[model samples]
Target: MDLEGLLGPQHPVAAAALISPAGVTVASRGADLDADFEIGSISKAVTGLLYADALERGEIRRESTLGELLPLGDVPAARVTLASLTQHRSGLPGLPRSARPLRRAIALWRHGTNPYGDNLEQLLTQARKVRVGRPRTRYSNFGFELLGHALAGAAGRSYGRLLHERVIDPLGLDHFYLPKAVDQLGPNALIGRNRRGEPRQPWTGEAIGPAGGIRSSVRGVARLVAALLDGSAAGIAALDPVAPFGKGARIGAGWITIEAEGRQITWHNGGTGGFRSWAGLDRDAGTGAVILSATSVSVDPFGLSLLTEHTRTVLNS
Candidate 1:
């Protein structure tokens, strides 16, 4: 597991680690265990943990509607249940259909402009104009962003405050943070990298935080995933797989269950202007891995391989 090879000419700034159920680091490479990286949609998984924690605390239930927690009055999304949103069955559009979304996407890819600058107030204002679709297993950043804030409301706390109280502090995730600005990411956070290998701005701000604004070190992710393997309440709840998401995947609260090397892999991946991330677990094997890279090149395929093929190969050898 030296991964001495990761220091190759083509490798981007990255950190990869394997962890055991007993909370031990088996191997790692690329960046130091403490280096921070923007974890993109994997932020949703953390939000899911908060959602589940709310459920366990009896503040909300599976049947709780967004209309109750949020003021999305009479809209299609308001009728959607907490479970539906968590499972990606809300049918909320991936991005709230706004003016010139295509142009905005172009700006995102071409210029690395932050797609999510609207704060909570602005986000709620935009939500009022959104159109919800049929309930299906469609991934929706809008759904999660709203859901995160809604849950925070239900618990009488801000989303960041709630997450820190219930998840980060409990897990001792010293480095996990929802930065309101790029400078707050601090100097230790890895510089983001776009496909063209240029530095990119931090994809942060309150509106985007719940859906994709988490920053964390490799050790933080490893510890969080390890807790999942050990039956932590939020961890177990996040993998309930309430609905079938796609051909080889089940839409658990926030995690995706897919097949790899004849094994079922529970995983989530994140991508931003200049970063990519992956977290996966082979529950039956009692093993999991976390991968983060500054370059936007996806770590999904390689992350799955390490959790499946790589682990299999190592076991056999």
Candidate 2:
């Protein structure tokens, strides 16, 4: 499954890194192993890990209600819980109606003055208007956004600060950060492009920072998967099959579950504007892979197949 030409003439820069459970990087691409990229929704996995860590430390309880933490005031869906948010069972709309308006505000802010502060408030107002769905499986970005806010409130710190203190700092993942502003990104950091090969301006993603704002490299993500495969003091753990929700499909905290070659595949994919990334771990074989690309093209099947094949080859050898 070759994806070298999938993006056509744009030729997106991509990096794939596979690692053993023992923390050895077995494969990689692009610059130094520690270089960073806009990792998109893979941030969800990190957020999940933070929640899990907080649960372990008794800083927050999974059963805690969102209303207790965020106090949605008059939002009818305030009954959501932390567990429901992480499991995508909250039923909130995937993207709020304010997304486009916020994006437009970000564009204008980039032109000269800052407009994202007002847009973020507008986004929160729009979010409160969202009606909850029946408790069921539906991918909702707003659910995670609420979780981020709730987690911050519970920890008594900002979301970015909490992430740094609990996850990145402990793991020694110096290259990863949730940028509060567009200028924080490195000049050489890869830019995302549309299907037509046009460069898209960087948008201030403050409104959805927790759901999809993380930036890291293939090597950094691979190291994270490595930690998950081998329980580390840094709080990473192997994928647990126990259904946190009812007896449904296997999903561990934040990572989705799939089966390949009779092995449990725990993985997540993320996309924002011009970037897409996928990361996974085969818990049965103690191997993991991370794929980062500078475009929004789907890379899941390719990343999964590569990880599965590579793990099989290495184990058989």
Candidate 3:
């Protein structure tokens, strides 16, 4: 793949990296491999790995309910299963029902401020007012936020601490981190630009960190992809598909698996107000790829193309 060419047009900053049995390569524009960018909902993929780890450690069970972990009161969300939440079949809305989501979205679009800045207590209070719907393959930020905190509660640690202890530390992903506030951001963190070329504030908050608030450098995510491919990452089982997501796609913990170029590709894409990210794996070929962009445009096609090319090369060889 023409990695440099692909990143050249990305607004402000973008980074792409690929890893195979041969090694890892990174190409970027407007930033180095160590510059952090908000990874958006790819945080769910991290949470998914944590969930799998929790299960393996016997800290939680698939049948565990939200009420068993979080103090969500007597609400429908409290009764949802951990399994359903992990696979996004929990029937919860993408955001808390009580959070006035439309207003928050309007604020985000008009002001470019963080709409998901609610703290954990606020998140729990909002969850108490939620009404669960029929099980389906809907994506739910609300569900993941709750699931991550629940996992943390089960492990007797905060989400950030738990992530560091279980995943980041072991993987040696130096620039991977969850910043609960803007001040926590590193000096090298890249400020994202909206599609209109306007600068936007970083999306950071303890409540939403698990769903869309983690940040990482190209090197950090590339290292993670390498770990996932080599079975050295915790919760490798999270990559296994457990349910039908959309047409011709299956959902795992937070990973999505689809057949492309005659290969089963497992991947996830994320978007916040001003950033877009994609990560994918061609497990059979022992190859993985990631794309992080400052603009909110979708990079899914580029990421898939890279992975498919790697798979095709392996098959031909």
Candidate 4:
């Protein structure tokens, strides 16, 4: 499928994987399939899966609220429903209010310092002050962060532990991990680069793990997609659309579904200070594709093209 040609020479290191009924095929430009790259907001999709899994286990319900799970006191965020959070209808802001959000942004741009290094306790502290608006489909990192922690609290475990026990371990996704700190990253983890080609620090924190702090290899991502395709993933139902998102889009738990070229594509894209990732699935065609790059550039067009193009090939084949 000319992965190299599609990726071009801009990316310093990138990996791609395509899965179909024909089986899985993976290719990389500068890194091996086992090399991990921060998947940014794709972490939300993983959290979405965990959210569904917890629901199925009777540990949490769609009606669950921040007040019912975490010690957020009687804040407005506490009244937000799990279902609202999953579908981005919780009315929480994209990020919890910061004392100096502009300073954080400038630091990230100039120095690539991690801005979301808050731990669980700090996260709860910030959440307690959040003022949730009326329920509507608005993407919110803060909401997902809270949702993931709430799920963990319900199961009496940490978010990382719950993720491992419920998803990674069960699927044997050894390369998939959530690093609560930079020290937890392994040697195989790639150092991401900003658009200017400068190396950036890895984004890691317990507070942000659920929203934008997952790392994985292309192989790990492909295997996860295969499970989702075969309905073996514990939270397969999370991919089902529950509410309308932006124009011409519907969102499920964390995944967004859209119609393109007459094909329904369920997908998510992520970007941090230095990394970018895209994953998409055409379930009816049993085809999926993922693109991960160490450079902070958009991979959505490539991922969508690969999946849709691959779907046609699979149908013809």
Best by TM-score: 4
Clash statistics: count for each candidate: 1, 0, 0, 0
- Candidate 4: clashing pairs of residues: none
Of the two candidates 1 and 2, the one with more favorable TM-score, higher being better, is 1
Better of 1 and 3 by TM-score: 3
Better of 1 and 4 by lDDT: 4
Over 1-317, each residue of candidate 4 has an lDDT whose tens digit, in order, gives 46668988778699999999778899887888789999999999999999988898999888989899999888887888988989988888887665255787899999999888889999888888877787777788888999999999999999999999988998998499999898999879999999889999899999999999899999999999999998878898899988899999999899999998998999999999999999999989999999999999898899999998889988997
Model 3, position 166, has a per-residue lDDT of 93
Which segments of candidate 3 are over 4 A away from where they belong? Answer: 315-317
Q: 1-317, model 3: which lDDT tens digit per residue?
A: 36556655655588888888888988788778789888998999999999999999999999999999998777788899999998999989888658989998998899888888889999998888888899988899999999999999999999999999999999999699999998999988888878898888899999998898899998999999999999999999999998899899998889889999788999999998889999999998899999999888788898899888766776677
Off by over 4 Å in 2: 1-11, 26-35, 98-120, 233-238, 241-249
Residue pairs that clash (backbone atoms under 3 angstroms), model 2: none
Please, what are the lDDT tens digits per residue for candidate 1 over residues 1-317?
54446323334578877866445553444456677889999999888888877877899998998889887667766787888888888878888766356777898877778777778887887677788788877888888998899899999989999888887888887478899877688557887878778778788889778889999988788888888888753647777666788786787778888878688888899998888889998888778888888888877777776677546744565
lDDT of model 2 at position 56: 77
Q: Relative to the unseen true structure, what is the Cα RMSD of model 4?
A: 1.1
The TM-scores, one per candidate, come to 0.92, 0.85, 0.97, 0.98
lDDT of predicted model 2? 0.70
Tell me the alpha-carbon RMSD of every candidate.
2.3, 4.2, 1.2, 1.1
